[model samples]
Target: MVKGIPVSFGVGIARAVCLSAKETQAVHVDSQPANVEQELKKLHDSIERSTAELNRLHEQVSQEIGAAEAAILDAHLAFLQDPAFAGEMKTQIQEQQLYAVQAVQQVMEHFAAIFESLDDSYMRERAADVRDVGKRMIKNINNPEGDAQEAYTEPFVLVAEDVTPSDTISLPRQLVRAIVAAKGGATSHAAILARSLGIPAVMGAGPELLTQTANGDLVIVDGTSGSIHINPDEETLARYQKQAERERAEMEQLEKLRDLPAQTTDGRRIELVANIGRPEETEAVLAKGAEGVGLFRSEFLFMDREQLPTEEEQFAAYRDAISGMAGKPVIIRTLDVGGDKHLPYLDMPKEENPFLGWRAIRISLDRIDLFKEQLRAILRASAFGKALIMFPMISHVEQIRRAKGLVEEVKQELRQEGIAFDEAIPLGIMIEIPAACLIADALAAEVDFFSIGTNDLVQYTLAVDRMNERLSDLYSYFHPAVLRLIQQVIDASHRNGIWTGMCGEMAADPLAAPLLLGMGLDEFSCNANSLPRVKEQIRRMSYESAQEVAKNALALSTPDEVKTYLASL
Candidate 1:
């Protein structure tokens, strides 16, 4: 058995099919100075062909899946068009007299390394994107007619050192039962695409996967538990075969609930929503039966670019989301850039304790110009549909008041300019800081709603760095203190006649569902893939039972005790 990070949830049993690592590995090829111009031309032509391929893949993925998943190809296209990326390769070929393939390999590896070294996990996953583009460019350079597609005659588990987004998307979905990679994390584009495509996937399994597993070896991939069993004993195989069938049945049952309301047996209806980063994701969100979008991460618009997004650009993105939801409320979180999430264009100072330093609401407050631009754009977009504003990492009531003041200023400016917008649009703040949780009541009075960002809340409440692998056990949403803080925020919101929603991993957790429901959480927002399962869990229990579970859970002494208690239910 091998342990890995589970990116997509499911169970699969199939014969192993190992993808050759040599296909992705770059080979060095030295060229002569006289052939530099020719090498450069080859490089340019390869990029053009890669661009066309990505464009076709983007359209294909958009049609097969949704626009959000297809958007992953946009990064590949961006890299192909990026002067910095192509120009670096051109320079390598011209100055170092290297072949186009070698230039691509070297320059891409250099960029991928820079991304891998970043403090941010999301940015680190981008290293895969860089390497993926390089592979495509190399392939196009070698075979301009395009390499023949691999034809799979039987269903098999795809084992690779790592799979790229393009490769994952281009795969024959019906024949690929699951994917097990020795590299990659949950945030990699490949993982994201797998989840979007509803395929079982286990990533970051380490190098042992390729070494130990052979082609035609029977493999059991328990993606939910991140366990891989290679040529398992008869007893283990039988147990997993049963589990796989159960998983399939459960998936079919969940699909039936997609169009149903997320209501408990006792008739309490919870607003089930999805957390999305881009406008294109709205299609996936709605397809999963999300009542609305609880968190539209506006920071994505400000990232992977050379400059701040103009008001019109921001407005267009927000408008697209609002329009896509077709009047379902869309809560747009303001620019929460700082800490691990850095923008190259923004002049932010490095801090020793970045998480505790200038970040989120702090940055927005300090940079009034950037804040108002986003607010104005959001407000203008509000006129098209039900749009709300949310501020993240607020430690006190002052931050909420100050942020609200700027929103008012934007509203006034829009009014003066005679622009149409929803004057009564709701305002909300993310209760992620321990300080904010303690003063929930005070903060609750200032905002129309509260969305607890438990990812950071768990970190701040326990003083645990969530990104630290060594301390992962200490970083849990099931922690007693974390649960109490969440309860406190929910209670405070209800007391003030405002609703509370959670847009974090905890919200999607089936084990945490009953406890949150019993705590009277008004809304549940998670990734689109988890919506059906979460809703199914809610539909299975009565509100009274969930409340009882919550009561028992709150009395628990430790995270394990709480989890054990929830599991027993």
Candidate 2:
């Protein structure tokens, strides 16, 4: 009778001790004046004790959600120490005739408002963290009973209207069997964290979930299937328990293969690269045997928060990511935010079709100062590791030329400052737009590499939005035009002595593996988890066989022919 998204599979018979993040605290403030400073001190001391714990939470989450996201609290540590933010709070209470607690509350909400309105989910989550720290501080001031972080002690499932990144920090990990939420789709940070932690989670159950389930009731969750069951009987519970154990075992078996090489039977090799958001993610890539980072989306540095991150903040992130790779290649893609990937700092107007609106390099060029600051950060970080500078959504030769000019300008400035950098760092462009693919040969001569963004390429080529499940079937990476465009890019890159790689979902598909192998792609960078299976397929065939299949397939006109060829293989 309960409704909620079921993120994980399996059933366990246990008493429910529900821990909901949306539950608010009354946050009593002591009335004594000079005595209140003593209480405020007690609260500050509580915050001080919790700081170390909060940081540990940050690292635990970093392990699950990438280091960059984990570092959100890292900046908060600095804010806690900030004379400006702290001084304003004290000033509001002492000089403006506001209560000490109200002063902190107002200060926090002021900052929280800036983040909550931002277009970036990463940034929006920070508002929740600010709220978290603020409320914790208030609880500390009040010396509330049984509020010692671990209020939830028994094994149970956590259901919430929504789960913010901060909600996971101290959520009684030992007690939480799985996560179920009424909101959040796949791209939400909550879903991403659940996936990383291998936790069963269901999201987007809607308002119906509010009343269906209650505390102290047995429930079943199937994360893999996204199903939830209320008051599942003994037989059902036993069956789901088996399913949970089996799936957990399978996941463990996969983890062991994390660092193994991804090579095909015939000796064709493909790169297993991690898609990351920050410099800290390099550690995960290295642990997973990622040849390198294929996509380092830099938008997190720009989106979700009030103002753009300082150059030093951005530089540290970039430097850490590259350094974490330990001399392995790190392809850094600059701000790919706008449209659906919106950043609040830019104040971009709402559009009917954000996908077709100003995004990626289009926004970068429009705000040259922000663009140049990023270039400087990349160049500065280049001294720390093997960093490749890449531009996204490039559609014209002039755009490439102008971007190169900015890079040159940044390099010149660095040279004047005597900073070390890979001035010869490879510059690559994403072949996503239809125009860029059509002019592949011309573009090939200008850039160091070409990475097929098949997600966008297929969307653009087929005139379908891949995000729209209704139009998903129409989104074919094997369309004749898509194949011919890929061929053009590959042939042109080979001709120009530049490398061509595929970083899109297509690169991970076993069926597309041989076709790409034959077409002569220099690198096949894909999700780190898919490496072995794709490698096994590549090992089964030779370069010549893949080439022939690719040739024959390209000559065919339909997606069915291409799929048939792959299936026959």
Candidate 3:
């Protein structure tokens, strides 16, 4: 068995099918100067054809999936139209006397390497797009007729060095049984797509697997265990088959609770919602019986672009999510980029500690124009459905007041322009910083509600960067201090007569459910796939018992002590 990172949670056994990235054709330098004009024409024509193909795929994907996922193609389309990019390639061909295809390959590598070297994970992932576009151009020039469309007649485990966003969107879900990638993390686009589709995936399996495994070999991928078994014996296959059957049965049991309310055995009601990044995910959330969207990551609209998103573009994306939810509350978090999520267009200065530096609300507060654009967009979207705006990384009462002040300014501007909006819309703040938790009472009075972003709250509380793999053991969400802070935030919100919800990784854990529910958390938001299991967990216990467990957990000194106490309940 080979160990790998478990990106998506599931188990699958299938025949392996290895996929290799297209290699650039070798180009020999000309002995004499080639006609520069002829090379330029050929390069221009290839770019046009590539743009047209991308446009066609974009429309098809938008119709089949949603526009949010289709927007991945937009980055490629923009690259094709970029004069600087074209000029660089043209210069390489003309000045270096290299073939058009070689010039494209060289330029793409140069730019892609820069992106890969960035500290931000989001920017690093974009390097894949650079390579993808270059491959498309080279393929277009080499095979102008476009080879026949590829199809899979049977289910197979897909093995690749790395999976790009475009590849994830284009593949037929039914034909791909599972994914084993040599590269990628849990937060990568390929992993996100696999989880959304309920496919088992093991990423970062190492390059050696790609070299050792042959196509058509039987393999078992256990996403839960983060292990792969190659060419298992009959007895081993039978054991895995049984395990897969158990997983299916467990899923069926969870689905039975989908239509039921997320109420305790003693009849205490709690709202269970889903956290989504795009408008398209609302369908899955609704299918899993989510009452509303606890968190809509609005920063996704600004990513993978060279310029800031226009107000109209943001409005349309926001409106699509609001309309899709069909009156269910959609709490959109405004522009939480910084730290691990850096945008290519933003001119943010490098910081020694970016997570604690200029990020989220700090950036928005400094760039009021950017903040105003997002506020205006959310305001316009509110007219269509139940929309609430949330501010992230806010630590002080002054920040909340300042942000609310800007909200008022945008509202008045829209009202003067005669644009209809929901004037009574609720605004909220995320309780992530330690400073915010210590004074939750003061901050609670300023906003309509509070959402605990425990992902950051845990990191900040433990002084461990969650992104740092070396500190993984220290970054425990179940740490006593994190729980104490959560209890404090919830209690503070209740004292102020406002509802509070948790939209973080902790809210999704089944073991953490009892502690949170007992702490009187008004709402719980998690990934759509985890919604049913969480709802089922909520239905199984009495509020009184959960309260006892939470009370005991708070007294524990260590994370292990708290976990042991919670597990016993």
1-569 per-residue lDDT for model 2 (tens digits): 44444333334335444554322343554554434464356545655754765677776765655654565555555556656656677767566555546767787788889888875444565675676666655555445344555367578777777765556555665667777777765445565556555456777777766567788777777764567776787788888888878756855765766666666546656666667776666665676667888878788777546788988989998998888888888889988876556555578887757778888998889889999999999999999988998899999999999999999998999999998888789999999988897788899889999888998898888887664433434678888888888888888888888888888868866678888888888787765545544565666678778888888998897997888877787
Better of 2 and 3 by lDDT: 3
lDDT of 1 by residue, 368-398 (tens): 9888888999999999999999999988777
TM-score of 1: 0.87
Off by over 4 Å in 2: 1-16, 21-23, 27-56, 71-155, 172-175, 233-239, 265-267, 277-281, 297-327, 334-386, 405-424, 431-442, 452-569
Candidate 1 Cα outliers beyond 4 Å, as residue runs: 27-34, 52-85, 109-129, 165-167, 185-189, 278-283, 303-307, 340-342, 346-358, 416-420, 462-474, 555-565
TM-scores of the models, in the order given: 0.87, 0.65, 0.81
Evaluate candidate 1 by giving its C-alpha RMSD to the native, one decimal: 3.4
In order, what is each prediction's RMSD in angstroms? 3.4, 7.2, 4.3
CA shift of 149, model 3, Å: 7.4
Question: Model 1: how far is 280 from its true place, Å?
Answer: 4.7
- What does candidate 3's lDDT look like per residue over 1-569, in tens digits? 77788777778899888875543343455667667777777788889888888888777655554444566677778778878877899998889876788789888988899988987544665687788788878767666676423467888888888876656666677777788888776656667667656788988888877876788999899986678888999999999999989988989999888889999999999999988777877887798899999999888788766789999999998999999999999999999988866676889888767788899999999999999999999999999999999999988889989999999999999999999999999999999999899999999889999999998999899987665443555778889889889999999999999989999878877778988998999999987777887888789999998898889889889987887777676
Ranking by lDDT: 1, 3, 2
| Candidate 2 worst ten-residue window by lDDT | 4-13
| Colliding residue pairs in candidate 3 | none
Candidate lDDT scores, in order, read 0.86, 0.72, 0.83
